[model samples]
Target: MNDEVAQQVVPRTRYHALFVVAILTGSFLLFLVQPMVARMALPRLGGAPAVWNSAMLVYQALLLGGYAYAHWLGRVPVRMQAGIHLAVLAVAAMWLPIGLTAMELPADAEPAFWVPWLFGASIGPLFFAISAQAPLLQRWYSVASGGRDPYALYAASNVGSFGGLIAYPLLVEPGLALRGQSLLWTIGYALVFLLVAGCATLLPRRVGGEPHVAHHSPAPGAGRVLHWVLLAFVPSGLMLATTTFLTTDIVAMPMLWVLPLGLYLLSFSFAFREGEALPAALTRIAPVLLLMFGSVLIAGDQQLAYVNALIGLLLLFLVAVALHSCMYRLRPAPDRLTGFYLAMSVGGALGGVFSGLIAPIVFDWTYEYPLLILAAGMLMPQAFLFDPIARLWRGSAQLLRIKTLAATLAIAVPLYLGLFNPGGLLGPMHEQVAFVGIAAIGLFSVGRRIPYLVALAGGLFLFGGYRAIETSLSGDRTRSYFGVYTVTDMPRERRLAHGTTLHGIQLKGARSRLPTTYYVPGSGVGQAMLAAPQLYGPAARIGVVGLGTGTLACYARPGQHWRFYEIDPAMVDLSRDSGKFSFLRQCAPQAEIIVGDARLRLAQTLPASLDLLALDAFSSDAVPMHLMTTEAFTTYARVLAPDGLLLVHISNRFLALSPVVAAAAARGGWHAARLVYTPSAPEKRDEAAISDWIALSRDPATLARLTGGQWQPLTPQRSFTPWTDDYASVVPVMRALNPSLADD
Candidate 1:
């Protein structure tokens, strides 16, 4: 009897281990492919972060379809299901060594619709095949192990997902080019297939074609399924929203995208694991964290950005784990595991659509972030921290109503103070007083859902949401596919901002025509523009890649032919057509404006048609990675005259980009010089901001003209790799991530 028991235990353990390995490999590849394919498509798609968000939507949709297919397969016999899935895997292998399709982007293609079509066509089959493996394999495990619990396997699955996500940015991206990365992923995929095949062999064979293992538990009702979905929905949407809020409004740090997603995936590991201590504790504290940190997030304090970013990530992780734990507790029998995952997938897809696709179009600011926080409050499990607080809430219906009304009244005071006395006219102490009042009220309201929600909403409003609402109501903000743009009227200047990065500033009245900000007369681009007529004559054909307030248009001579390549049409409207700034209208009214991605548009221009070109395109503070690659420089070389000058604006708060430009110059056999211009005390008074720019040219003499006073020869860093369309990683360039490289 002991030997029989021991033999059964040994095979069961081996089978469990096989399924774990299979699920892990499949999930790792599933996430690894996401960033790889997006990187490959950068040259064709342009480098707006929105492009990444759109790609995430496609991934979510495919994941939904994959889960649905897995659920449907459960109706068939277990052994037959395995055969069908293996065949599906074989068919998907046809798309191995994945890459973007050969379809050309049409000139008038809309990114919202076009991006999905391109990515969907490129990796749809492979992603679908890999995505189905986790749920499918877990179901197989239940049957093969004689109905042992399979939910623990889900924890292992998410652990693999988190590994893949972190590895792409840290390991795979820095070490390999696109071709090598694709090959590596292909090898991984082949390994996945073998692992899956091994797991399938352990399944019991029945000649009668018996139905899948049955659970005695009843099927979940419609309401229960919807409850599972809502619990899943808020976290998925909040993940995207938190990412956007951190990078755009808080700080545009490289690899910041990984944190929210990594934590989100890690939360699943903790939520579904067998141990209850960690997730239970996190859920118990989540509501308090949401109330406190959610308010701080909306406060918009730039001075404390890094600290705030950390707090925001903590808030997102806690909320996600807490909500996901609720779903785990309500999980059905192993027989219904695939169905549960299908419903969760549907919620995830819907959440992605709302946050990634719909919210940007509907709200000028990041309203979805706060709104999702409110949704999380409604869904996350809550309990009193102490017994007395619970008794007060559980006493009577009349008492509950009175306490709720009192909480609402207490919250109203801070809201009114924030809205009316935004400048703290009530006193320097007013803001602190309001903060304490709201915190106290919010703490008392805990354990009661209605009162707690009221407190959370009040905190959101009182901190910084009122200001966002004010900006939106004033019609000064506009949101597009790229991002939000705001026009702020300052005392002496009118400024256009993309997120926290100032794009352009036009001084009032007589100075409106002068190039201010980074285009001040002493800047490198300024020196190049001032000397254009002397070098190329008055008929100099100049092309500018970015048209911020059309500031460079002021450098156009009477007979000089000028053109501006701008990606966002809304920028053209704000700078030229809206009469917001007169730089284009007053200086170069007839300058040609070409609206499209700078790289694609420049590729279409006649070779050697321009005497000089300036590359100044930016999405918020981030320069598009594609625009800085070696292949992009080849396009720039093709478009400019043999001796024509190229000016690149390298001024950025978070990245040390001079090395990248220097390396590109070295690889392409071009002479390069960099100028670091710090505005004089007088220039600062006149709105001349400090700027860094690099000038490169094929002819040494052309670059020599600008190398004397402020310009110095650009030295290539031995440690830095020149970016190419096939390979680039921002990890080494980020100032916060690489403190040793900050001074570079």
Candidate 2:
């Protein structure tokens, strides 16, 4: 009897190990493909960012489909479940070595529609097969192990998810190119298939076509299921909202994209498994943090970027873990695991759609970030930390609720006064002091929902809500496919800003017709446009990629047909309409403006047409990746006359794009020169901000003319990999971004 028991124990242990390994490998590979395929598509899609959001929608839909498929397989026998999954894997293999198919988006294509369609058609089958592995394998383990707890294995799956997310940025991307990453993922997929097959063999056989039965739990009610969905929804939406906030100019690279998502995945592990004590404690204090940081973050442009970034990340981690914990706490029985996960997937998909697709269209700013943060606060499981607090809640609960509302009013009134009472008794310092006091009062009601929300609403209103509400009331903000833009009216200037970066600044009245900001006479594009009549004759056909207030429109002359390629329709409206900036209306009323992605639109224009084409498009933070690639330069080359100049605005806060342009120019067989325009205090009139422009041309005479006076010959960073449609790495650019860091 001892020997029989020992043999049986060995197989059980082996099969459980196989199940664990299968779940981990499948989840890891599943997340690994998401960013990999996105990186591959970056150059083709440009840095519009809506592309990534749209891609996320496709991923969520496939995940829901996979989870539903897994739920359906529950009715089948264990062996047949194994057979069907294996066959599905075999079929999905046809689309392996996963990469996007070669299909260029048409000029008029709606990215919100096309991006999802493209990704769905390309990787949908493979993702569907792999995504089903976690919940499906966990169910198989329950049957095989005589109904052992399968929930703990979910922790393993998320650990694998965290691993995959971190590894893509830290290991796989740095060590290997896209081709290598794709190949490695293929190997990992094969390993997952074998492990899953091994796990299938451990199931106890009931013999010839018999129904394999186990302890089935009772069905969950609609309310209980709805609770699961709502719990999952807040965290998922907040994760995407945080990503959208962080990536815009804070750190506009692919690696930073993983931070919010990586934390979100790791939250599941802690929320589900043995490390419950730590998450529970943090969750209790999460409300306080949300009240303090949530409003200030949404207010934005505080100038303490690093501190805000850290606080923002912390806020996301706390809420995500806490909300996910609610999910783990309310999880249904093992027999109902598939249904539970299906609800989770549904919630996740809905969240993605709201943040990624709907919010950008509906709101003029990232209003979703604050709204989701507030939702996270409301949804997170709450309880008083101390017994005294609990007694207070029970005894004076009704009084406390009313008092909480009054307390919120009191806090809000003082905060409102402080923000608006410029100079004398209350200033910025007084505002900070009021916030400190609010923070202290907020800490007392750590787990009480009403008091906490009062504090939260007050804090939000105090920190940035006052300003945001004021801006909203004025109705000067415009939200677009790219990001939110604030058209701030100043005494001297009317500025167009995307986030913290000023896109264009037009001086009021008569000064508006003058080219200002980065387009002043001393700037490279400024100098090039000044010399256009002599360089390409009086009938100069000029092209500009980015039209910010149509500042360059001031340079247009008679018989000069100027064309502007602007990606955002909002920009076109603001820059051209006589009611807005008036640079285009007053100076170049006849200028033809094309509204679409500059790269795609430029390709559709007449070939060999322009004297000078200035590439100045902005996606708020960084230059559109698609615009600086070799292919993009080739498109520009095709549209220019033999000696026509190509002027690229390379000035950026977070990126060193001079090298990128130099490499692109080198690859396209053109001489290049860079003019780094740094304005002195005296030369700062008419909004002449700092600028950097790269001039590239195939003709020696044109390059000589552009470089003769102030421009210096551009040098390519030989060690830096040139950006192509297939590959571009931001690490080197990041390192060279600062003088101090470059030496290290």
Candidate 3:
């Protein structure tokens, strides 16, 4: 290996520079392609958060498969390895020039079961091959550069991932149409294929004429593999837990999932950085921070979005750095890099499954979060500064045991009160006091493991588990595809809620159907439904999308036909059952109720039948991406009578939905006006606030009549960017929030 030739193959050389460049480019291209394709599917799949969750599951499964295949090929000779992988890549390209199939989702199928089926049928194989790129290419970089630190390349990989994530919301989505985005991804994939081939050429044919196949060895033992699984499991579940806590209780908005996942990936960059390592001291402080912050996390709804997000992310980073640093310490030598990654891949996949799948089924609530926090506490490595104090604590001597027992009693008394005594022990001020006491005790037990374990148990019992149990015991709770709906029964009425925001409310036994809370008679949907008879004559056909305690059912009049398209079967059952609010039974008992996704069901309706359509289908904070697409508006226009009205509900604490509706109305040649509802009082029974609703129609008369009554123009939001099917932005809406926006 002469100087000039070595330079050609080495880190700073022309060839080596291109090698690094190609790997980073391929990773960027690969990650960018994921969101692009998933966004394309939104128009067809409808904007159920389940759609994105399903797509991510498919990607995780394929990624694990790819890593496993890479591990297997490490046993093959270098040339044969390249040959096989190239052949695999070629086969994957057969399905490319990517676009979703023309197949429609089944009208009757459950979204939980069908979304995975849909994504798997569409692009599983291509994603699997592309997902294998990072690990395999990193190994090749190690081999090509004679085992130089290739770990820095991983930082480049996540940087690309973050770039892709940011680009979807900022650039690719809002800028290009779906068709254009697909073609661009296809071109990038082609470039990646070429790059992989070029990278293969740089691999050493045989090191000193010895086979590269003989360099690696068998898989790790079960104990070592389980250690990897536990380390990976904590961060992954905690990420999802953070998402649930933030969105469900703290804030509900579109695209909030991105931040937690973004931070999770960023932590990996720090964990694996080779040259600049996380110090041992930082690792030691992390557990204490975890114990401290973990209690604060479950300290009831912070409602402080930025503050809570900052604290949650900081806690995740500290724990992730501590745990992943452990994984880094356990990392095998460069020769076993591929096998080491295979174990990690297994752990990553398992963690996702536990958090996404098993947790949802096994626990009625989001219990996986607290459980994972405990797991992180168990796995975190700790050491004590005072050896004598630690020995006295662990020993079973009579006086020492009595002192230990007294310390245990001191922690338990307050913890029991905090956890079991409702507002007594874990009250507002007591939470912090209990946490400080626990942290002080945890300091004494650091290196010994059991003290930290007790502290973690004490913290969870005081913070997370008790509240979770409280929310669980009250039958006021309801879980559906939309999210957790808690039915709050008041003195005069009962309210249907999605998180803290009330969807609909009905008086104890009212005769006339009056719009309650955000659905004031003067609001957008209210005005449209109120004017339905005048616009379409006495026999006007009305279609209400989404059934929330059947509140809209009360607007029906004699000789007027009405229908409701509801997605959740649970909602349908609740609305009709005698125990719940009987708006349908009391108001429009004869109205037809079609079950399934409203957009899909709407496609089956007779053309020009509906004189008025009101879209009120919001599942928690999830903006059904499919409903706001240009094609969806077209469907609404097709079924509606020429002079009909369309009313969309946009009252959300998180997303500014009016701009998206305005964008659709503009694209579809319909006139649109928004009505912002502000109630006279903040706590005056949720049924009294004005619902932020937008009304649109092709007929000037319909729009005029609907706006004739107390309708006010919603101040046009300059910061609100129109969200399209091809691309959407949540930043504008999130930024528009005033500091004083109080959580209900």
Candidate 4:
């Protein structure tokens, strides 16, 4: 029987091209919808940092569902599987253009619950239908082509996924608005459907009196399956960690999310390709790369956003390739391919859940990042880079000495401070000399796991992890859905920081009543506050969105009604802690504080109630994409008095959002002007950094009165159109990096 089937088996050339095209197109459509739909949903759900994380969890869950369905389908005849999958695609198409449905989140809705529900309901069916094609098509190709190597095409599928991710940010998003991008995706889905049909045609037809082809390979054992899952989990979890660390702890550019994901997708191409050596070479050195980059990053400050981003992206790529190569090495035979992919998808989903959802709730810091890095070190295929190191590890006596030395060095945290302190005997270059010694000691333990881990620990501690440890010990840090906040006490003042940006700095007892940071008396918000009494009467009602240590609350006067819409409860707690920031307690103790997503909470508030509404809720460098939407602007207009000024803080390192706010203001038929505040020097303004605030009002006179000296008409580019909820793009607003604004 085996011999007869062997003779009848067809050459791979029969169906390879059709299967490749189907898989590539489906994979491309699968990844493209992720950023697109999230971008579309931004206005409805304020762009809290966790919005994307929640979206990723939804995508992974749907992907696991699709793969499981495909694995179950493998029990049926090839022709039947193809027909059923085609039917699934046809049904999913009813959700064309992949736009979100009109769903309003209540002011009290928990984003952790609402985000997944919204995304799952909007694009769940379509994403699932497409996500199944990669593994399902490969299974079909295996049987249709008579047991050829279909696994290599998995590499091709990932190549297409990487292309789609790259194209969306650099090519697709920059040129096309949300509407056009959706339309283009719909067209691509149609093409992919047609391609799936073409692949079906290549399947051998079922004939009467013929048994269905049963091509079963050796089933993998439980241990081997578990190994496959572990390999897939590390890289998947690390990708999410790298993304969160970059956008949350560093800069929150929408496009930067794709870079890690794209590199992750590309790692599959490197791993699964036949006879490839670049991946193997990278696997050999990936641990060292992780050690170097991870250590530097943990010790590294926020001053080098660009440099840190570059290092972070490269580290993610290398780790992904090395770990994915392990998966490629352990992949099952063609007949067992569906189960293999199912396990891999399960691992990926669990990883996403762990880092994206569980980590925030479970820990006060991004501890998952370090734990995942250590797991990568344990799981990735390692080899002796140098013969001497290999010989040392192979010999027990020498290995013990090496381990002892690593242990000794790992605990020597103060040795670095004591000898290499910049102010100590070694001078300014001592820090560099210390890191070099640490790196050299780390290099000696290349192949041995215990010693290598010791080195990783020593380097990580010496560099970045120390600050986190200090913050943790101090009990001044709090992690929430929005991000992490750290409160530090300086001799002159108490400072609250949300990620790298200072949320507020309150001077010690005597000066605690004064606003600091972006709210200093000379800044844009400061100018608005200084004019509040003259612009509105003493009875004016003031509303502030983003209660960052309640610094703006200090602007309150007697008889003025004030309220704050703060998204994170942690922020509200810290602001009112009095022990941390006294701006609210000292100035406006009775101020009403609403805890929920700002826009949703604002919508619930009475309309046209406030004399002025300040949109100062920024998570570090991120301008909540949702808050800047045209619908959000309309919401602000409805809530503000006819002559009220809508103040938007637009100071950013990456995006020139003055244009975005100006454009939205124009679309709302409001007059807009901007105030650019540069403190000149740190000492001159009591640590108040530069800030650019745009003022919008329906009344021309209100805007005119606010413009002069520091205030000027915001110049909106002629071709720029305001971003509405249904259609908004940030690509054009991305500012060119200049020397002065390098670290903004």
Whole-structure CA lDDT of model 2: 0.79
lDDT of 1 by residue, 36-85 (tens): 99999888887654677778878988999899999999888888999999
Q: Give every collision pair in model 2.
A: none
Of candidates 4 and 1, the better by lDDT: 1
Per-candidate TM equals 0.95, 0.92, 0.88, 0.92
lDDT of all predictions: 0.87, 0.79, 0.72, 0.79
Highest TM-score scorer: 1
Question: Where does candidate 4 stray beyond 4 Å?
Answer: 1-14, 103-107, 206-215, 251-254, 395-438, 680-686, 737-744
- Per-residue CA lDDT of model 3 for 214-264, tens digit only, reads 654464678987898788878887887778766775567677777887777
> Which residue pairs in candidate 4 have backbone atoms (N, alpha carbon, C) closer than 3 angstroms, thus clashing?
298-464, 299-463, 299-464
Candidates by TM-score, descending order: 1, 2, 4, 3
| Candidate 4 lDDT by residue in tens digits, 1-744 | 255545544566767777888888889888788888888876677666567777877898899999999988877877788889999999999988779888877766666798899998899999999999989999778666766678888888998898888877778876787889989999999999999998888776642223333544578899999888888888889898888788767666756777888889988988888886888888888988987777777544678877888888888888889888888888887777889999999888888888888988887777778778888887877677788776765647876787667555663654366244845765666555566666666677667676667667666666657768778888999888677788888888887776666677888867778777787888877877778888998988899988888888889999899999987778888888635777788899999998767887788778889988899877777667778888899999999989998889988767777767877877788888888888766444556777888888899998787678878887666777777766666677666633432432
lDDT of 2 by residue, 613-640 (tens): 9988855545567787798899999999
Model 1 — TM-score against the truth?
Answer: 0.95
Ordered from best to worst lDDT, the candidate numbers read 1, 4, 2, 3
- Candidate 4's displacement at residue 441, Å, is 3.9
Question: Alpha carbon lDDT of residue 374, candidate 3?
Answer: 81
